[model samples]
Target chain A: MSDLNNGRYGIHGGQYVPETLMNEIHHLEECYEFYKNDKEFNDELESLLKEYAGRPSLLYYAEKMTKDLGGAKIYIKREDLNHTGSHKINNVLGQVLMAKKMGKTRVIAETGAGQHGVATATAAALLGLECEIFMGREDTERQKLNVYRMELLGAKVHAVTSGTQTLKDAVNETMREWVSRVHDTHYVLGSVMGPHPFPMIVRDFQSVISKEAREQILEKEGRLPLAVVACVGGGSNAMGMFYNFINDKEVKLIGCEAGGKGVDTFETAATMATGKLGIFHGMKSYFCQDDDGQIAPVYSISAGLDYPGVGPEHAYLRDSGRAEYVPITDDEAVEAFEYIAKTEGIICAIESAHAVAHVMKTAKNYSKDDIIIICLSGRGDKDVSAIAKYRGVDINE
Target chain B: MSRIKNAFENKKAFIGFLTAGDPSIEKTEEFIYKLIEGGADLIEIGIPFSDPIAEGPVIQSANIRSLSGGTRISHLFELVENVRKNTEIPLVFLTYINTVFKYGTEEFFKKCNESGIDGIIIPDLPFEEKAEIKESAEKYDVDIISLIAPTSEDRIKLIAKESQGFVYVVSSMGVTGMRSEIKTDLESIVESVRKYTDNPIAIGFGINSPEQAEKYSKLADGVIVGSAIVKIIEEHKEDSGKYLKEYAEKMKSAMKN
Candidate 1:
């Protein structure tokens, strides 16, 4: 059995859900422990990840961007190539399957940019479970197309109109819903955040990214890269990519956070930079909150990166100095989206563009032959409409 | 005796619940007196939180209304302190861990001690994680109540062994809401809890009408009705005191048998 104590990423994670849901959480934890290593479950999950969603997404070298920057050689691990068009599919497949194993007939999830919701809805439909997604009213409006796509996939969508009416509120509404129908329902929480087992399970599922990237990088470069970078929105993609590299003592791990206007201002979503240690959404992690302890509303041009609190493992890494988390403003992320579109001919999601922006911001310091790998977590199709509006070119929805 | 233990003396305790600062702080103070006058043995005052995962829509809306009315945790402390001047009824805060954590765990507990808080019910803080505030709560002589649900079948005895003040036996499986009927096997659960400790056990959650209060009082040491009373306040708003007085009196009379 997987040790329940292991879920705590060094004084970070714990089960903080209400008593009504504790039984379900404990049951899920037990199931996760049993099935995660069970042969039949692993084989099914592997086959789906590979034959279904196209596992081992390419780690392509961006030669032009490397040459143009005249610094470190950059390669992107293309999670965008996966079915559902984002890295969220990786964890969703494992969780939805586990929900089935647990005898849950209905599945629920919360989304910020609607990527996770779409991915959850996709997995639930394929698995033949009833699916309901809770998205903040504001997010449903921001990512209107994704909302349509989720409904198209046969998932009922609930517009959450709670505090701030954003990602935080969506999670609150989802948890409340999960509490109400816990006996037959499973909350397919997205990202490497939330209570015990979730952080551990998400990291384990997402670790596939790093596992494949590591083998490819070792095979191609013959050595590890100088630094590994990924954008941190609830830190799933970054945790997945960083998990396999934690023991590679010499490799620098960087997580780029959404600076919104700037970290100095209250509008930022740079949780690691400007937030304090607090409990929210079931984990004791860094959160952007006010003096009264209310979860503060956060913003980023990239809707996905607008969450106020970060994953507990990210908090542990920041404290241990194993990873460096820095802020990138909305303007920089937008510029990087355009830059990567032009330089690499790959339209990266605004969320992933934060990582690209980090590379551009610090490219001057690294040696010309230094190598860098960026976990390009999603495609920008969903972001294009938002990006267009940002540039004052209102695209008709 | 602790105020909580004293509340259960002789008759089955009738616990009343209210969201502090709902509608307004002044009205909340008035209702506290009215609830006690109408025979509330103990009071559970809920501090408004932006995200209350354990609450149903009724209580959730009450929290939002309270927060919007300019209520803060500090203000609630002040309200409790003001109420302490006139009464000695047991009072406990029903809130999330974040609310206490943000106030500094030790500082929050110490203030609770000063303001006459008998205990706290943090729905989000489970048995395994109670260690987060247990030390501070103990230091302040404040009991940190543990909740037991029907789903807590295997772990009931373990939780009951260490339950302070009382074991809040949740009669239903879901969030805090008024239920017309509670199907959980309370006698069996209470039977399990009895083997562990002699600390009084109280059944709460989904307890609405006097019938529920009477029904649950027979199964445990006490009965706690929250949503039903909060709904009364929700309906009456500023004039909730008079209605709550009648509701609490009715509930207390039902529990007397």
Candidate 2:
């Protein structure tokens, strides 16, 4: 119901694409509008979330984490327990269902960390849609397990080899594929980016986190939390957690970006804090660029966070001063990774450790009475080898 | 008539296209003046985007060269600001939607108006999503030019209705580049566009040779030759303006027929 024409609340989302994909983008926009309000669409999405995705993930009060921090009371929203082991399933399910509703029999997605591909494959297998995932050749090597998992889910995986064979390249390949096969296929975008309706639609689907957390927290604590924090990699998890709280003036939104060495170094993707305005993938957003404006390479222990740009909406939020953006160094993130694993017995994804590290540093300023909800964006099972290798420990042993 | 409107009416509108800062900002300024002297009616300064999905190798390399020359959105404003001091030739920015989005839609139009930019042509921004920009741009008296492709008939009418400046009729199917021969269906495309709006239509893309320019001019109100001009400038990279002037004059004479 929001007027995209007004670009209200910094949500000027749309499909600004080449003529090759204009019809496809327009068709998708129409489908999104129709299904977004249709009762049947709502019922189908609800049924999938309840029956398949294990909807209404809990907001667990981390008493031990709270006491250990000794500053702010900490609560963890358990997106880690959802199907596909992350909040990514929430969006994958919504998009896959939309694809089904549009009568598309095939689905394709691009992935860096492989979480999105796995999530998409899970939905495709369940919904009986043919699935194809394009992943960077480098990522396919590093995330062999996920590649195999997608294959096991009956999805064909293509290892992209073009232009810095990574997430961005995979995106390029997926887009090319979408352009060629726009009739019977849908490109299941993995984040709150790309051309319009996508940033809005994906945010709407993933916003269940903030929506449910708001009610669940109010029921238990009788008030809204002072601040909410999440790690940003294409900003899906952060956007999901921040959407419901954006209108609430009382709540502070914090997004932690990957700072590979430090904010001063060239090897980081802390776009909101350090990037200049530039176009990347298909949308305008904050991008890490060199003196000549060519996109510079970004670094992070987590493959997912190793992208050169952040979502356009995050850029808007940063510019609007509605949210505070910060960077978590690789060393600090690793330390937090160890701290959480030893303290909470929960090994978090290296990407999520960035948020935990930020919370650790920020919590020092607040009193024990203040409540801080950190979106436990994902579990650390995928990150154990990298962390172990970083500490010079053998994961093989 | 205004100088810009007069050029169109007299059928002497010299259309110029160059990536904002090719080689360097210093040379870009020099080239703009050379084109103006060679009788350029309007200048289409391309603001480079990283992924120019709709551009061929010529414009793509021009963009790459400009980016290497440290060209940016801020630099673009500076270029327009400097150009305003020298010439009153109508200037239009040819860029992707992302550039406008990053510049903040409202702020972009305001800056263009302040910098004395006369028009904008975002090839990637379709008419369906341009209401806000159209309204904002109209307030500043900045024209939003629209593109009409060879395949476009009904869409050309829709674009013309929403458009403020002259319609840019793409003479071919592909990205901006030069070709030896004009497409066969260009006359029909131009004829179809004439049915839509009373405004002058300029045909671009693939209008390289003088013969092709002459042929295209006979169909449309004006002819736009980019890749060929850019090629001439690139060939004489050290003295881009001198070569650009020579090529522009040749192309202008060809269109005059």
Q: Candidate 1, residue B132: CA error in Å?
A: 1.0
Distance from true location, Cα of A52 in model 2, Å = 3.4
Q: What is the RMSD, in Å, between candidate 2 and the native fold over all Cα?
A: 5.7
Residue range A156-212, candidate 1, lDDT tens digits: 999998778888888888898887778899999998899987999899999999999
Off by over 4 Å in 1: A1-4
What interface root-mean-square deviation (Å) does model 2 yield? 4.3
Q: TM-score of predicted model 2?
A: 0.74
Q: TM-score (0 to 1) for chain A, all models?
A: 0.98, 0.96
Instruction: Return the TM-score for candidate 1, rounded to 2 decimals.
Output: 0.97
Name the lDDT value of residue A101 in candidate 1: 90
Interface RMSD of every predicted model, in angstroms: 1.2, 4.3
| lDDT score, candidate 2 | 0.80
The candidate maximizing lDDT is: 1
